[model samples]
Target: MRTSRDAPTRRIRAAVVGTGAIAAGSHLPALAALAAEGGLEVVAAVDVDTGAVQRFCADGGVPHGYTDLGRMLAEQRPDLVCICTPPTLHREQTVAALRAGAWVWCEKPPVPSLADFDAVEAEEGQEDDGGPYASIVFQHRFGSGARHVRRLIADGALGRPLVAHCQTTWYRDAAYYAVPWRGRWDTEGGGPAMGHGIHQTDLLLDLLGPWSEVRAMAGRLVHDVQTEDVSTALVRFGGGALATVVNSVLSPDEVSRIRIDCERATVELTHLYGHGNDNWRITPAPGVPAGEAAAWRDFGPDVPSSHLAQLRELVASMRAGQRPRSSGADGRTSLELVTALYKSAFTDTTVRAGDIGPGDPFYTALHGGAPGWAPAPATYEEASA
Candidate 1:
């Protein structure tokens, strides 16, 4: 791996923080693929646990390992940093990377709250200038299926998107929440709505555009965890479309789905974790020509939504010196939607897109001062015990 001093411009220096399952399972593999293509070099890995960091770096063939993120950033000065740390660390790590002049690709629930997200945003370079920007991992918005649907909706081929339903219902038992950060508000952010459902919800927002308001309900239906195990919301989009959202961890029939009822056709995606063109179906309204509907089904080659898909786009953006998707306003919009969902559920009032900001309590935390709503997460020691 050549350094920027001698390497071609397309081959960037990259690092990973947090040697957790996500870093190992998703981020590292994506980086490896990109590295094989000479797009970027995986230079270093960082973690709180020295042993874990060493194992991660050694097993992944990353050249350097450090226990401190600051030390790694200072030493390597990577051009891109993939942050797979827990939610609590996202804002700080992203800010640090951006401050170090590295572009950031942080995992979902980007930060615990809108304020933290905004704070990370403040560290970014201006749009016209070369970045040092922070991008969030919302990979569901990529792949050919999502792109096809988004283009159809945007071009009015799907006609006006009148109504939609988004669901992220996957089963998780007590053992799943055994991790210290898994069920905590202060750590993992919030339950399925923030940690799990944010993927599908972000894709929903990406396809449907800005949301006008949300009225939601959330509860701890099954798990003894501090956060809600289930949540539902009625969201109104700025374009006058309405969507019903259901996020849960108690479903036996596991699925992640988004169905939109448009004037000309009804488009739906049904899949578990990630989706491909095969998981998508488009049905034209009665009397609409089957030929026109066939054209709508042309999603081209299948590209399942994955870390690699979004990572490829990010690397391309880095090469072109352009802002990538799931960054800046796009990334913040998803976090804001999740925040408003929580606030609306807790307050039992409709919350708008701009309702939560610097002064708003929800802007700072998902709990948002709602009476008796603060979750007390178990300490790491207790969780491990």
Candidate 2:
């Protein structure tokens, strides 16, 4: 029997860890809006930098700030905890929150390695008994445009999936990596492929389902960071579709594009950062009806996919005692793809779906337990920038 506990009307008490750009720019604002509507309350914030946390709370109207995560968890007892810290810090913080009886919402590149992600996943409540669960911020999958096309594909309006291409080619100059954690393997994980490209590619995986194999290569083409600035991969999906993926921080004219060719039509979305209905287009294959193509592009009620969209869904799912989309299991798909890409690039071999597991070195580190390339020399201005 369903009870009142299944549909919470009481506002969700929330706390945020890490006061970085992503927290300030995306999470905080969305949370603030939700709080304004009486759906959530920003109870506390945690950051290693006390001053940053203080400023974040003051500016965002949060009630409390703490320098330590454990202290915040103990004192606030929040219903939802947002882990906005760097990838390296994600595992410990997420596990701590889940064990503390709070549902967690974490940023992308959820953890530095698959082992760490699994460790965090193990702490969550099992099955539907859900008092606590965690979700990764893969907002690209929540947009109405992507939602519309995904429906079309599922309904057989798009027919059999055939081939596809996805790209995350955006430039981040030396100044961008000047931050201490920007490019190191231990810190930011694996450069553009892990940090930047994972967003679009996660959406691709969401649309296409499980990938079967990947052949790839990565290199430090321009940036002085320890990780690669560019990477390219050829992927084979379980649904009998093929794809070419490219991740690069060296391109001047930035764009995020994904094009899928199906037996009935070709669907494409092109935009940088966030996307709207205008950014998506569809073309019917030869001899196919023109009306289907028009209906494909006619996504109703333009909801630009963003952090807020996903966050709203996460909160609602928690209220309903349900594990939200992009749960640990859902997120592992994209992270597994990242692991496979790194393994393939470094080993000079094609990597299969289950090739990387407990025994594999790539399971622990994206670099396969090998030492990474030394950071290139930076000019004084570049270093200071």
Candidate 3:
């Protein structure tokens, strides 16, 4: 429902929760940039650790900081709230903010499980008009490369996408796993599949379609952690398209790539050093007509940082009385894919998407919390220290 004329003239008042690495590294900077551009104004910050929140405010010159989220919401009444907490805390905090009448932009892996997502969804429907509408942070979808690929597919330039392969091979050492929630089944969700490879998985889902079935295997091959460090899955899309995914935190070097083979051509992209698509390759089928080759055009620099672009969109949607591009329902789809993967891994069989829903036992177990899965206490002390 948002119109172009609704572009925010003054800063849209905003607040942020969780002052950890992600908040400092991405959300804060992105919001600050938007504030400079007259898109958003960060009014307050909240975190369980009072010292951390105070320090962050001091460094960023923020006006207010609070240890309690409810108090901050009551006092600030921000139009926007950024949930930068871990995957486990996303559902509860996001729902709280939504109930408090603040629009929410939560980081990726919006919920640890599908049941949690359902809880949030149910609450979303019950909230008043002034309450927040939630959106998950899947920034890669905002990238030019992703958009270009989507355009090609939508325009039938790539023909019918038949098979897709996604790979996210990265390294996470003991030092990385030293954090309390880095490699846990409970607090951090699964492992590399949920934590590291989720970005690429989201991109795959964005380009292709929703998954219908998944067969997967997972193991903790490298890290001294409870969750799997490496995982792979065979996914079947709704339109009979087949796909494969490889996610790992133990590769010698990091290589993030996706290849989609369509009926007419093959599209590929690689983001080696970071999340940016630095290299792209498109190849047409052999003996294809010249006109088809001409249709394949390379796009120019149009990539915006996902966090910044999504935040801009969120603000725009709020001003226009419209919903965000990635809503809670959209987030639930991705989480369902993840849940299918986990179920497939545990049972050593293919798991259908329909088999896991709000009332299913698997769904119940996921939200009920995984018992005997706590990381060593030293990890907490190290993270807090």
Q: Each model's RMSD to truth, in Å?
A: 3.2, 4.1, 4.3
Query: Tens-digit lDDT track for model 1 on 157-273?
Result: 878999999999999988999987788888988999999999999999999999999999999878988789999999999999999999999999999999999999999999998
Residue 197 of model 3: what lDDT? 85
Best candidate per TM-score, number? 1
Worst 10 residues of 1 by lDDT: 1-10
lDDT of 1: 0.89
Per-candidate TM-score against the hidden true structure:
0.95, 0.94, 0.89
With a 3 Å backbone cut-off (N, CA, C), the pairs that clash in candidate 2 are none
Best by lDDT: 1
For each candidate in the order shown, give its overall lDDT on alpha carbons: 0.89, 0.88, 0.79
Give the TM-score (vs. native) of candidate 3: 0.89
lDDT of 3 by residue, 1-385 (tens): 1122244465687898999989998899989998898767889999999899999999887899999999998898887789999888998898888777677888887787777777877766322242347888888777676777788888888799999999999987899989888777678887878878888888889889778999988876777888888889999998789999999988988898889999989988788533443566788998878776765756667664368867777777777666677786666777778778877787777898778876565684442232333343467768899
- Candidate 1 or 2, higher lDDT? 1
The residue pairs found clashing in candidate 3 are none
Those runs of model 2 whose alpha carbons end farther than 4 Å from true positions after fitting are: 1-7, 371-385
Q: Sort all candidates by lDDT, best to worst.
A: 1, 2, 3
lDDT of 2: 0.88
